[model samples]
Target: MKILLTAINSKYIHSNLAVRYLKAFTKDLDCECTIKEFSINDRIEKIFEKIIEEKPNVVAFSCYIWNIEYVVKLSNLIKILDEKIEILYGGPEVSYDGEKFLSQNPGEYLIVEEGEETFRDFIEWKLGIGNLKINNIKGLYYKNEKEISFDGERKPMDLNKTVFPYEKDDELHNKIVYYESSRGCPFKCKYCLSSTTHGVRFMDVSRVKKELQFFIDKGVKLIKFVDRTFNCNHRFSMDIWKFLIDAKTDATFHFEISADILTDEEINLLNTAPKGRIQLEVGVQTTNNEILKNIDRNIKFEDIKEKVLRLEKNRNIKQHLDLIGGLPGETFDMFKKSFNDVYSIAPEEVQLGFLKLLKGSSMRFETEKWGMVYSPYAPYEILSTDSISYDEILKLKRTEEVVDKYYNSQKFGNILKYFMPKFESPFDFFFKLGTYFKNKGYLDRNISSADYYRIFMDFTEEILNENTEILSEIIKYDYLKFNKKKWLPTFLNRVVEKDIHKKIRTELKKENIEDVHVERFDIDILKYEICGEIVKDTKYVIFDENNEDNIKYFE
Candidate 1:
């Protein structure tokens, strides 16, 4: 039998580890199994054509919220075109409500949670072609002419025995590959599907090292651990970290860690890691006490702040912080506080996302209790709650784009630093800036890189009276540091004595300084950089352009 295990991924750079695991587990079976992956961005008709070209007897799709709608439509078309082709569905989207989904979709069977064992057993016994036997194949809902029935749930497997899923390392180059050293999670954050399961299971440290070595050898650019909380077990996490630190491969390893619980040993070990070796994504969903309780996410804001700050001091590992906008108890005002709290940490990246009331999660069942309304479809993102209005959420949605372009993009770091203190709080500054962007229709269309500076300047003139030129100076310094462009933007081009560059170039050469690219500003950029206080003086900023750390100031 020819079986095709398909994956509709969210992006071209993302590889679906689930489909790979399915293929790996059933490797020894009699069936000729092939794995086919496509992006959700692909046209539905095109994907259908590709799937039909495979000419498989059985087609199984690894479903998820991002691509379930497309999968269901494709399944219907496949069944309509050729009834002889058998279809199977599995993954988080269908595992929770197999009965309702089975009644609606065209799939002949549904493989519930932890499908590696269940799918193998189904193939061994019988597929839809032969006998429709719904015997003791654990974690499956089989459909017959009479009705659809589900077998019992499957038990979780030992992490040590799970085979390495990625047989094709050549496909992972320059892509964001996913790896899992563990399964299940310790925390019961109600919003997450992980809360449905209990206990954490980890793979053996030695085995994990060997698998990582495989990726390093293959030149995989990134490997993001899918473990719910990578740092839950200090010993296991530390062993993995130590191996990576000692091996010192060029590939970057990323982990989603619970920062508040980080031990001093973990912090010290991570500190010693070579730059670009490790990146951490810390979820600080919110700092609001009421909202945290409502979601059953137990974390102290102070402890998170302390640990993140300690890690930031080392400057080796890059941290990306997350904040959710529309949690149950987080009103617009309350979310502002949460935003400011995370902003105080000064992470390298800030990801502002809305709460997703996913299926199989405890929070999804309690939506009525909280007066929450979400889209009646896959990826049920919260629209409004009793505490927050839909209009307020819309504003927050617009604000997210502004943050991505300005703050998260890291292009306006110095510009934000010079102007953020002028407002009440970080949230207020961003809120007002987003409002300006919305009013001017700048958000409606794509703004060029230079136009972004001009838009911000116009917004500043509307709000503040003076200090526009100083803002331009800050932007000029930021832009020069960004790229190797010799010409400045029209608005940013400043007047200076014609011989200034020659004199500065001669001075740098005389002092044995390698960088000759320099610019003079009327204000004391060096003193203002140290303390926020602006000191007036004729200052020359020697720009290395290539290295930010090499930037120096001359009086």
Candidate 2:
């Protein structure tokens, strides 16, 4: 028998650890097992053709909320091509509704919950290894005569017994490899699936260290920990972090952590690590205490803020702070306050996301009680609630776009810092900018970086009554720092005499600078103090291609 464990990821950069794990665990089975991955952007016909070409007797799909609909359509098409092909579906999306999903979609088996042991047993039965009947397999749902029947819930597998999925796959070296030190979450946040499971089961620290060494040896770019709350067990998290830090690989590890739970020692440890070596995604869903209580999140806003600020002080770790727009008892004004509060901390990235009422989450069951109305589809995003209307949600959507483009992009940080105090709050500034884009019909259009700068200049001058020339010069300075190719917008450009270029070039050459270009702008370079002090009238901004850090001014 031949088996193919596959998944359709949302993007090509993502490698599905689920399918890889299934294949690794079933390696002992007497069959030709392979892992095939595709992106959702691929044509269904092409995917079906590839599967048919493989001609596997068994095909198991790792489903998720993002790819469930696409999987269903593709699976149905596959069944039409070959009815004899035994199709199977598993993953969080179908784990709760396995019966209903199997009944409607094209699949004969649905493995629910921890699939390592269950999949191994099912594959053994398919390969006829022993008298192990299908009914004996726990965590499996199959058709018995006319009705779908399931074996009882399966116990979580011992992580020590599971094989590392990346042991054999060479292609994963350049992709974002996901690693987990533990299973299940300690907290019961109402909106998360992790709340349904109890107790955290950690993989052996020795095993985790070995895997980290393997990934480090491979020189993978990123290893994102899939653990719900990576810092729930402080010792386990620290042990892993220490191992990675000691190894000192160029690989960057990403983790989703609770800020309030971080210890001073852990913060210091992170502080000493190399810059950009580690990234933390801290989810500050909302700053409203009432809403936090309603959701059963055991975190004080002040405490989280202090911890986040402490981490920021280190300046080594890249912090990605998150805020969910729609939550229970959160009005527009309250959300604006939440936004302003999170934005004040100055995280590297502020991800303003909406609440998704996922299946099997406590929030989904209490939608009516909380006056929440959501889309009845995969990734069930909240449309409105008693405190916030649909129109307000629409406005927040636009505000989210503006935040992503401006503040989150890190392009207008200095400009925003200078002008944010002009408004009542950061939220007010973003909201007004979002409205400006909507009025100008630029909200839904594709905008270049130059166009974004121009739009921001217009907003500052026409609406906020700020000096556009000063803002333009600051933007030009910022733009030139990242982009080596010397090009300035018309508003920012100033004519430089040939003699001035020659004089600056000579000075740069004396300083052992290479690939230096001189540009003139109508702004006091001394006033725009970036890194070093500018002590004289700066008519020209000298840009060095080889060294981005070598930006200087010459009169």
Best by lDDT: 1
Reference-based TM-score of each model: 0.92, 0.95
RMSD of each: 2.7, 2.3
Instruction: Kindly give the stretch of ten consecutive residues in candidate 2 with the minimal lDDT sum.
Output: 529-538
Misplaced by over 4 Å in model 2 are: 465-467, 524-539
Candidate 1, which segments miss by more than 4 Å at Cα? 126-134, 494-520, 536-542, 545-549, 553-555
Which candidate leads in TM-score?
2
lDDT of 2: 0.84
The sequence of per-residue lDDT tens digits that candidate 1 reaches over residues 1-555 is 888899999999998888778888888877888888889999999999999999988899998999999999999999999999989999999988998998887878889888788878888876453554566678988787758987688889887767789865448885799999999999999999999998999998889999999998888889999999999999999999999989857889999999999999999999999998999999998988767888998888888999999999978999999999889877899899889888988998889999898888999888888899998987898899998999999889878888988898888887898888789999888888888888888888988888887776788888776558778877887787776556788888666666877777777777787645778777777666667667667777887756776777754
Q: Candidate 2 at residue 264, lDDT?
A: 89
Instruction: Give lDDT per model, in order.
Output: 0.86, 0.84
By summed lDDT, which 10 consecutive residues of candidate 1 come out lowest?
A: 126-135
TM match of model 2 to true structure = 0.95
Candidate 1 all-Cα RMSD:
2.7
Give the per-residue lDDT digits (tens) of candidate 2, residues 1-555. Answer: 888888899988888989878888878777788888898889878888888889999888998989888888878888888889989889999998889988887779999998999999988888788799999999999987678998799988778888888774477765788888888988999999999998989999998999888888878889999998999888988888888777768889999999999998899888888888899999899998889998999888899999999989978899998988889889999999999899889899988889899888999888888899999988889999988998999999889998998887776666676567679998998899999999999976788777887787788888978777566666777777666455677766556588867877787779787587777656664364553332334477777777866766764
Tell me which residue pairs clash in candidate 2: none
